[model samples]
Target: MASDPWQGHDAAVLFTVLLTGVPTVVGLAVYLGSRLTRQARRRTTPFRTWRDVSLAAAGAALALYLWGLLHVLFLDGQEQAEECERQRPEGTPALVGRRGDFIPLRLVCEASDGRDYTVVIPGYINPSLTVLLLLALLGGVVSLLLHHKQRTSTRKKG
Candidate 1:
């Protein structure tokens, strides 16, 4: 039996995955959004200043990062990694069967402090996303809403 029974919990897995990836993803969005704004300005500005050129370059880099971020967010990752030390299971020098084949998962703690645990990140990964995944997905979709706002503002000013 594995100590970290909660290892396969979907929500935990998804959160861990996204949380790990967010920094890079956000950086890309910023980089791209900045560049995009710059490029738009360049089309209107004949001065062709370094500022516009720089913005365009930045935007390109940002877009590249954004793409990379999305690729990472959608990437396949393991469901869970339960830390054995947290559980403090007893007896084995090294726990058996940390890797390969679906073994039984039992959350056995000893009667006293009982059995601790061994960390297990199952090799098999399920492609299901949890509520966190859904929220992240929703946020991604809702970001499109900003386009309407930008258009509305541009219309009023123009």
Candidate 2:
């Protein structure tokens, strides 16, 4: 059996997954719960609307990020290995190894002879994640500001 590349990093990966996954699950639950509970309510308040949109956007961003991570963790190394094997000269014997980076989420194949080839992720993933995160942040801020204004207005009228 092949040894797991992520063996020692299980805890860190699990923590990272949960950090993103929890929000995703929560957002899904909130969406479903609201839908089920408010079947008759066609009109949504600004705060609720913004809050839901923010949660959904955040969830989407996290989910995409998670997908990218999983792709790197599982698929990238194997693919890179194959590419390295194909690139090696017929008579040369060189071992191919993987190196990973988490912060920027990258993997590279290192041949024994000091040559390195980077594993490529899909082009759209990072840019899409960035846009979604920005939308989520904007929505959250608007939601919070609207909620505060509503509360203050109520207090003044009461």
Candidate 3:
């Protein structure tokens, strides 16, 4: 995390991680869940299977997801580094004292493109919790379906 000695606050890393990590796991879980449910049916006709569809979909989703992750992890870091390298001259034109929204550009210099580069920092979203939430939801639905199926099967057995 890079910061000016003067700004006294920073939030670059937090946004970087959440924005990057969330979609990756959510997409994967949805893909696999839909697949497994379809595959496990007792007798499905040819040319249709849930497992096949889910797994196939995962490939495309994963590819697009990786590019997003890379942009967050790599490109954002590069931009933030470049942004921090240029700071405003110290004690010149005190933008803080007389301002709207009040950021010290003197302490934080703008990049060549007139954009402030942001550093990619670690964020809250991780695979474990995302998968857990997915499990809870899908597991509940599947359990209900399975219970219903079992009751039907049992009544037929009787």
Judging by TM-score against the true structure, name the best candidate: 2
- Model 2 clash pairs are none
By lDDT, the better pick of 2 and 3 is 2
Question: Across residues 38-120, which tens digit of lDDT does each residue of candidate 1 receive?
Answer: 56656642223333434444434333333333332342323212343344444544422222211222222222333343233
Q: Judging by lDDT against the true structure, name the best candidate.
A: 2
Task: State model 1's lDDT.
Answer: 0.39
lDDT of each: 0.39, 0.67, 0.40
Measured on C-alpha atoms, candidate 3 has an lDDT of 0.40
lDDT of 3 at 10: 31
- Give the alpha carbon lDDT tens digit for every residue of 95-136 in model 3: 221100111111133433334322222222234334434545
lDDT of 2 by residue, 1-158 (tens): 13643221244674677576867767686774675465524766788788888888877877777776666556443565665566655555465465555555555556567765545455577789889989999999999999999999999999
Q: What is the C-alpha local distance difference test score of candidate 2?
A: 0.67
Against the true structure, what is each candidate's TM-score?
0.24, 0.65, 0.26
Cα deviation of 97, candidate 3, in Å = 19
With candidate 3 superimposed using the best TM-score fit, by how many Å does residue 101's alpha carbon deviate from the native?
Answer: 23
lDDT of 3 at 20: 59
**Clash totals for all models, in order?**
14, 0, 2
Task: Show the lowest summed lDDT stretch of 10 residues, model 3.
Answer: 97-106
Q: Please give the lDDT score at residue 104 for candidate 3.
A: 13
Using lDDT as the yardstick, the better of models 1 and 3 is 3
